[model samples]
Target chain A: MEITELRTPCLILDEKKFRDHCNWMKDKCKRLGVNLRPHLKTGKSREVALCQMISQEGPATVSTLLEAENFFSWGVRDLIYAVGISPSKFSRAAELIKKGCRLKVILDNVETAKALSNFCEKSHIEIPVLIEIDCDGHRSGVKPVSPDLIGIASALTDGAKLVGVLTHAGDSYGCVGSKACRKAAENERDSIVLAANRLKEAGFNIEIISVGSTPTATFAENWAGCTEVRCGVYCIGDLVMAGVGVYKLEDLALSLLVEVIGHQKEKGWVITDGGWMALSRDRGTASQAVDYGYGAVCDVNGKILDNLYVKLANQEHGVIVNRTGEAISPEDFPVGTKLRILPNHACAMAAQHHSYHVVNDGKVIAEWPRFCGW
Target chain B: MEITELRTPCLILDEKKFRDHCNWMKDKCKRLGVNLRPHLKTGKSREVALCQMISQEGPATVSTLLEAENFFSWGVRDLIYAVGISPSKFSRAAELIKKGCRLKVILDNVETAKALSNFCEKSHIEIPVLIEIDCDGHRSGVKPVSPDLIGIASALTDGAKLVGVLTHAGDSYGCVGSKACRKAAENERDSIVLAANRLKEAGFNIEIISVGSTPTATFAENWAGCTEVRCGVYCIGDLVMAGVGVYKLEDLALSLLVEVIGHQKEKGWVITDGGWMALSRDRGTASQAVDYGYGAVCDVNGKILDNLYVKLANQEHGVIVNRTGEAISPEDFPVGTKLRILPNHACAMAAQHHSYHVVNDGKVIAEWPRFCGW
Candidate 1:
């Protein structure tokens, strides 16, 4: 079926571009001499994961346990639940571990590590955990050089096994060019490796050292001590990645398929049925060098419409207007005309839909299912 | 089960508060002497609809075809697909109508009216349509006084029935105080009534003159020429509604229940598992009198925490900080501590979850399922 026949405000994934992106990340990992633990938090589809993972049964990272559970059910066993572990989630993690899934959890504080140890000891199950190092002070994680690093690792005494350290250069998203991204990558690598070395010196056998972010992974010239690079969003590049200079605009593989519904000629607005519900309320590109209001506009064939952007979005209505304050002709895009919208953040956009219309050369080849929630 | 036992980053709906909100809206509409067609777009749950609607068979408004389909299957006969109808969605709308649904579609232009007429003529089915009018030049809809109103009305000849005129005070969201909302409400009523009068003067029978928005509906003193007022969101008050002065802070019925995962004590950050994925990226109150970053922070008991807000959000991590720049003690909210986050926009936050844990008297009584997608 053609994409035009599908319902409006639905996700459209370019199969060829998606495969190319996967191959690029795989090749990049090979060149860097690091394992690519493709983060399933972005694509969140088994079909995409089939092409992303090096092996169908191993090496993946997920933000939520639901992703870990779903991927593990699909035979991807070597998974890392990348977010900080809370006690409420321990039972679910333990269940997955007991089911023979090699699921690893991450934590930053001693309190959580002690709690996990107690829970694991009581449940009679052993779980591997990675001490999260705060490389950029971006979000969660312990400071790389702080004493709490060893404190957290030492607290994992009974059923919790200390593996190594993980750090993400989340601040790399703020970097605009390759130079800044490269610096962020080096800082991320140094931070994690320093923490791992400290743990090793303290008599803890550290094996794994993970570090990554889309921008940092793309521009990192050195991956000396890092064993694996955990990066998502690069598999389906978005406007945020494009603005950060990690991926070009044409490399974005996701777009929202919508049809022209009405026009406000005097205001140069061409409205569509795709609103925040479809594109998401993420304004990742609002503070970037180029602000694509909600999303950048493109034709159904994926050709960029030079100056058009979705300026204002309602719940179910997107008002497309010229960025340069030029008038948009209603005759050019009449009602029923199909248009594709490139999202600002791929993960946020993909999270809004349950399935993707896998399009290749102007035809939808298959429907790849995706799930959400914790 | 207690809400504390439920998973983190899940929705919690206050049953008593929700019922109270429903009753308040019902009483307000009764006093105004207008029909209250509760827009099902906000509370997209059967259980919640049981309280909002006047009967099982609804006079409800939906933002998407999926909502219309789901509500119709639940024995709702009278429904309106409130967004502008696109050609790709016509078949789905027709199927619902053919299944004995009194579904109405709204549109603004002559081209779509002609397309609907042609489609209906070919399929030999009758469908009613409302002419969408531009009340405040906010988003979609044609100008209320435009000559194209008669042209579009005339084009709805074949199998399409001209029902009446409809206008939503979407701009009313920009109004802050009750006085501003009252003026916006008056303007919304005048705009739709004027359009209905124009269509009637053209010798066309106009039956439904509908006008509403949460703010406008809450403050509308005169429902003079309107037959029905369609309002959602107010049923589950949010920070946006509170900021608009339509609903007080204590009236918000929906919140995201999340558990404390870790912290950055030096930075006064208390990180949780509920991020943009749960709370949503709708910073609807950012431009209001007081900005609640991502959401207003509250305890699990739904008590508002003084000066605390979710200042920053990642995909699966929410970094909360004090608005007054005061230091936060990690000992106060240790690991496994649960907190409830009041959302910025009820519609956007509610769309992030699949179900709402109905909390009454500190216990989770039932699980009410909600859905998303177009």
Candidate 2:
């Protein structure tokens, strides 16, 4: 069925477009001679993960255990709990690891290491953990090149198996464009190598040195120090990617299908059914060179309407403003107008919806529900 | 159970605090001689609604028809759907009206008015409509003094019935303190009255002249022309309310319980399991008087420890910084230490959780699961 016949405020995924992205990224990994364990938290759909998991037992990264549980049940074997693991999460991780899930956890401190090790010992499980490195002081992880790096890594191993170091060049998101993103990638590769060498010198054998982030992974020129890449959003580019010249609007395969409900010609505002609830409240791209207020408003065929941008959105109502097109006259878009919205941040937006209305050749073909919560 | 023993990433609601907020607002309405139609979207729990409900049937403003339906199913009678009526939502509202829900919907333009009217006509439902007036320009609604508003209100009644005029001073969120919020309330009260007067002069009898926003309702002065007040956030005060000086951090009844995961004492950053994913991506009070990045980091007992705050939040990790603590460390917190995170915005944060963990006298008395999705 066409998107118009489905329902208002639905998530539409272009099947052909999605497959192309997955294949393209996989090919990139092949050419770079590295493994690609795509972060499944971006899609959160088993079907999307399977479509993208063209090789192996489907290596993936999970933001929540709920995702790990869902993906493994879907037959995905290799998985990394990307979020920093707490003592409270030890039992759950041990349960999964002992149950034969190739579950890897990340840690940056000694307290977590002791608790994790104690929990593993009590459960009679030896979980593999990657020491998270803070390439840049963006979010989580420890400084990879620091003098205390060996101590931190040793503490994290705490009787558990060591799987080298993993670093994400998340700061690449702030890069001006592709050229800058490449530099960020090299920085990430070097940081991991420096940390890995330090660990080996300190008498630790490391097996998996992983580095990933969409911008960095997409533009990496070196994979010498990295065994696996963990980029996620490349499968469905978003407005933030477009803002940083990472991808164009045409490359966005995921968008919210919304219906125009009303318009204010005098005020140049068109109200629609898809709001922050569908698109997400993440204004991640707002600080970029070009601010996509919420997302670029488009037509049913996923064609960008010249100057229409969703300026503001509440719970269930999105206020659309046409920067061009007859100055947003009421006549420009009447009732029952089906529109598509390119999300600012795909990861955040994708999490809000339960399922994606899978489309191929401009018509919906199937439903792929996503798992949420802890 | 002690806060730490209960659960991590849980929503804790204080019964005594919530009841005081509700009673105080109702008492204020009684003193001001105005009708209090609390918006149920904030809590979205029937139990919370019952606490806020003063009248026999309980008057309320709903953001969605589903909320209206749910509340009506639980015996609520007087309700106004405060959100702008979209063409897609017209049928549902019309159906509910036919099903004996004393529901009134809002509209800002003539085209949507006509569509809603047509739906009501086809469904043989007499829908009560209020013209949404934009008083603060924060979002939604027609300008209170716009010339075409009366005509739009008239059109909606052709197939249904015109209830009156409504305005929500969302700009009150920008108010620095209670005095400014009081002014916002007066502005909201005046805007609704002016719009009602305009409609009256156009040969219409206004049945409902309403205005609200927690800031305005709690601080409003004169409710002379306003037949009803619509406020939502007061029932569960948050960091936004704390920053607005409307409530202290202690008054914030709901918080996200998170476990300490990691730390960098050298950098004075402590990481917790609660992040933007669990807390929501809204930096609601960042621009207010006190700019707590994500939220105020409180001790397990809800005590704000000096200048500590959950500064930067990732998907599943929160960076807690003790602005001026001597040697503050998540290392000291250890892996099992539990903390409370007061959210920036109550509605958005509450929406992310599956349910509220109701705490009375420091005990989890019940679990009220919240329904989500569009």
Candidate 3:
């Protein structure tokens, strides 16, 4: 099927570009002498994950247990449920672990670690757990130098094994230039290494030390101490990655296939069916050097329409406007004119859809299914 | 099952509040002497629609074709695919019509109207279409007073039936007070009614003249000359509705059930599993009077946590902070402690989940399924 034949506001994955992104990340990790455990949180499809996998003895990271179950069903055994697990989800995680799915979980506090330990002991299941280390104090994680790290590690008793430490340089998203990105990468590596060294000093055999973010992974020149790097979103680059200088506009592998539905010519807007529901409400690049309003509007063939951005978005209506205050005539983009929209954050946009119309050379070569919900 | 036993980061529908909201809107519409065709775009669940329906034969408005199909399967025979329709979606809309569904599609331009006429002619199907009228120059639709309105109306020939006009006062969302909301509501009513009158003068028997928006429907004192009013978000209000004065904070029927996973004690931040993936990135209230960061933080039973808001969010992590810069001890919100988060935009937040756990009197009574996709 042709790309234009698919329903408007549906996610479109550029297959060739997606493969290129995966290969680039794999090659970058190989050059840095670190194993690449590509995060499945970004591309939650088995087809995308297979391209990212280094071998058939798969090791991948996921943000949700749903992703773990989905990928595990597709023969990817080694998986990490990267989010801090609550007691409520232990049974579901244990179920996957008991089925020979080497599922690993992460946590930052002692209270949850103790609860996980209790659950594991009761179920007679040993679950490999990683201590989430805070690299830049961006989101969730124990401070790299905090004493609570060891306390939480010690709390993992019975059937819970303290595998190693992992940290995501989420603050790397705030970095402006390549120099800042490199600095973030260094901080990300140093922080995780510091926590690992502390764990080693405490007599814990820390096997894995993972650290990564799309920006950090793309620019980091050093990965000396980290054993493995986990990165997502690079598999399908977005405008956020582009704003961070991690990817060029052309490197973006996903776009929403939409059509011009109407026009507000006086307001210099061309309304499309791709609204926040399609492009997502992620203004990841809003605070960046370039604010691609909702998204950077593109023509049908995926070429960026310079200066055209989705200035305003309703639930099912996206108003595309020229940034330079240029008026766009209604005739120029009449109703039924097909367009593609590059998203601000690929992860959020992709999550809105259940499947991707995988296009290669302007033709929809395959349909890749994506699962959602916790 | 108890509300506490449900999984984290899932949608929780307050059944009592939802039913109350529905009854309030029903009463309001009755007082105004206009039919209420509740828009199903916000609460996409058929269970919610059943509450909003005036009768067993529902005449609801849907934003997507998937919603139309899902609601149609549940015996909602009358539906309006409310967003401006393009030629690409004609076949799907036609399919629903052929299946004994009274599906009404909307469009605003002559180009699309001509295309729809051609499609109808080829398929030998008389599809009902409403001319979308622009009331406040917010998004899609032809200006109610424009000559193009007549041109677009004339284009709908050969198996395409002109079924009057409709307008959404999207700009009404920007109004601050009840007075402003009423004025916007007046404008919405005047514009669509004007368009309907013009179409009738042109010898077209216009029947269904419709106008609405959550804010407009809530505050409009007069509904004269309009046959029906449509609203969606009122069934499950959000921070935006509160910001617009359409709903009080207590009136919001939807809140996300999330667990406190970790925290940044020094920063007075309580981290949770409900990130943008759960709460959505719709910063609808960011420009409002009181900017609720991601959302207004609430207790387990849906009471707002004074001074607490989700200040920052990651994909699977939400960092909540006190607006007054007071440090909240980690013990106050220990790991595994559950909390509810009110959303900035209910439509965006509700779209993130597949189902809503219906709670009544502190107990989860049922699970209502919701469908998403184009």
Top lDDT model:
1
Which residue pairs clash within candidate 3?
A: none
Candidate 3 A-chain TM? 0.98
Per-residue C-alpha lDDT of model 1 across residues B116-210, encoded as one tens digit per residue = 99999999999999999999998989888899999999999888999988999999999988999999999998888889999999999899999
Candidate 2 Cα outliers beyond 4 Å, as residue runs: A156-159, A263-266, A322-327, B55-57, B73-75, B324-327, B330-332
lDDT of 2 at B183: 91
Candidate No. with top TM-score: 1
A57-134 in candidate 2: lDDT tens per residue?
Answer: 678888888888878777788999898887777777777776688999888876677777777767777889888998
Local accuracy by lDDT, each model:
0.92, 0.82, 0.90
lDDT of 2 by residue, B1-374 (tens): 56656657878888789999999999999998888899888788888888887964788878876788888888998889887777767777777777787888887878778887777777777888888898987777888788888778778655568878889888887787879999998888888888899889989879889888888887778899888888899989998887777798889888888988777767778788898888888877767767788888887777777788888887888988876655675546766788888899888888777788888877788887775665
* Candidate 3 chain B, poorest ten consecutive residues by summed lDDT: B53-62
lDDT tens digits by residue: candidate 3, B292-351: 988888899888889899888888988888899899889899888899999999999999
TM-score of chain A of 1: 0.99
| Candidate 3 CAPRI level | high
List fnat per candidate, in order.
Answer: 0.86, 0.50, 0.86
C-alpha lDDT (0 to 100) for residue A236 of candidate 3: 93
TM-score of model 2 vs. true structure: 0.94
Q: Which portions of model 1 miss their true places by more than 4 Å?
A: none
Judged by whole-model lDDT over C-alpha atoms, candidate 1 comes out at 0.92
Classified by CAPRI criteria, candidate 2 counts as: medium
